[model samples]
Target: MSSSQQSKLIRVVQIIIDVIFGGLVFASGFLILWIIFTPLILKTSDISITASIPVAIGANDHPQLPVEVVGATGKGIRAAFVSDAQGTLQLETTTWSYIIISNIAKLLTALMLAYIFYLLRTVLRSIRAGSPFAPENAVRIRRLGYLVLLVSFLRPTVEYFAANEILNQLTITSPSILLPSPFKVEMILISLLILIVAQVWSYGLELERDQELTI
Candidate 1:
């Protein structure tokens, strides 16, 4: 094949790879938001929990709780809200709130991952062309890598607290001011997986950028 033809083929391949990678990242963000909102949607049923039921009728027993909502939007929006509830945990409380926050973080993280993947594909094309330094792209990729790392570091703190608090309450293993830990672990695991994927994509971009810069 002619050199020009070969370079064109390589660029086409890069574009294909980028499309697939970008799709995955986009789906990741959507999935994270779904995870966050699942509880709220399911909890549409009024959730009642007796912190302490009185044996006698007319016993002044009430369960007051603070609940928050967490989640992401299709267009890179993150949202959260709080409600004061009586006798039942609001849909806003429990893992839903944390899910919203986690998904929001995940949405941003997903964008970083997608951008990194794009950078990698570009660098691959540059490599094939024997024109090493794609300096502007490299710089941007590096910045995105750093941002991904920062987001990853923040995720554990955000994911774990909600999961741990709810799990401990449900399991009755700890007096944490949370409840109904049933789905906490699942939610957290999903978030962790997303974080890992985002970080890997980010680092991969960073490496590609470094290689291009060096060449």
Candidate 2:
């Protein structure tokens, strides 16, 4: 395709992504508000918190045995191992305020991601305007990469404590189970790629300045 055609196509695609990310940010905000206020408005005594846990059935003395028994006894003895002997634990809380507070890390991570997308949209706008090597764009790209790296590390820590709190709420006597690693190799790689692209943009900016001086 011609350069003009490609530019137009890219502009159209960027606009589409911008709109989608904007919508997602709006929805996330709404959900966060709902989570904060729902219990208060509805005067509900308990909010349900759900999480996955590994369960083994061979021994009745398993750490999750009490939870499993409580969950399954409601159905029948035969139905106890319905989830292939592993299942999710659901805890009800009269104190949802604390639960919401504990989950703020996840919400913050989501907000940061949305902000990154917003920055990306701005960069795309600059590109479409034929000024892709703007200094601010490089800074924004670098910031986006750093934020992704930060969230990647923060997620596991937040989830570990949150899961422990949930288990505590359930009154389960078992020790906190080791959660799976939340580190995503792909995310780290993508962050590094973005930082590299920012440096490339910096080099392009220098070249552009040199050409302008020559002209």
Candidate 3:
């Protein structure tokens, strides 16, 4: 595409980033207020917190509903269903502490995301100004990479602790599964890829300087 078209596309993307950044800021603020004061503000027993958790169903947990069977060929083998094991967990409590515990991770993630997008918007602004290889952008990109890595680990860690707190306050139930893992391989890979891109950006900035020097 021509430079003009590319500029327009970049501006459009920047606008989208701005929208997302605004939303994140708003959400983070809302969560903080709700966590700190909402319970005191709205005193009622109707409040319920809902979240999802990894779970496992026992081998015999399948529904007993009969279904049409084909001609029996091989012997039926016992099996069970496993997934990125997940189930919904809901708790009704008027206690403010539990509510805060349930939502703290979401708040942390949202604020981190807003910061990421803020860096992204600055990078895009530089690109839009025709200095796509600005040196500071390399630092910004590296910061973004590290921040994402932190988020990848931070999110699950916080969630695990928060959920564990709730679990500690309750009784155990059947069909148990492990809690969510602290490490998500895919997110780890993405952070590494971003770090690599930051290195590439640094190289591009070096080349930009060399080209200007040569001129």
Candidate 4:
């Protein structure tokens, strides 16, 4: 293919990759919000406590749900409207809405990481094709990589605090017949690696641009 054709193809691929990655990131966030907030909404509709119970006592009573926020002083406590099987909304400070939210956040963060990897691969492919060094590309790629790394770093905190394996099935399941977690992660990494390669290619394109200008 002519250099121009090759460049066009690279741009097309980059656009496609961006669309897919953006979708995944958006979906992950949506799912996370749904998982975290749905239960609380249910609880709010269900429970109503008359007074604040000692957090320690309530936590022991309801181990499945934990409602403690940590801080420098000690454990921070807040009252929440919770619901149970009975159609009564009760106030409960010992309610564990955080667990639900944390589980979703963890899974969403993981998916975001995967998307970042995919974006990286697209960037690399573009670079390999001798694309011009557009600062926009570099800034975006860097921002995405940093964001993914930051999310991954926070994942452990979720595991440490709430540590619920709620969305493990949803997350672990293959979204497509051709894609599994291993494959997905692999593709994402490859995409990112390609993006890095693209940077070099972009340099060449700049040189080409300079040569063209001289001619």
Over the stretch 107-172, how does candidate 3's per-residue lDDT look in tens digits? 999999999999999999998888889889999999999999999999988988887787777776
- For every model shown, what is its TM-score relative to the native structure? 0.40, 0.71, 0.82, 0.40
Candidate 1's C-alpha lDDT? Answer: 0.52
Ranked by lDDT, top first: 3, 2, 1, 4
lDDT of 1 by residue, 1-215 (tens): 99899888888888887887779686776777676656766588565321221111111231233344656355655665443232222223444544454355445556656765776677676768675444544454455455545545544444444444444444332222332122235445554565565466566667877876995
Whose TM-score is greatest here? Answer: 3
Q: Candidate 2: which stretches are off by over 4 Å?
A: 42-94, 98-102, 173-178
> Could you give me the TM-score of model 4 versus the true structure?
0.40
lDDT of 3: 0.78
Clash number for each model? 2, 0, 0, 23
TM-score of model number 2: 0.71
Best by lDDT: 3
* Evaluation by TM-score, superior candidate among 1 and 2: 2
Tell me the spans in candidate 4 whose CA falls farther than 4 Å from its real position: 1-19, 44-98, 107-132, 156-202
Question: Which of candidates 1 and 4 is the stronger one according to lDDT?
Answer: 1
Local distance difference test, each candidate: 0.52, 0.66, 0.78, 0.49
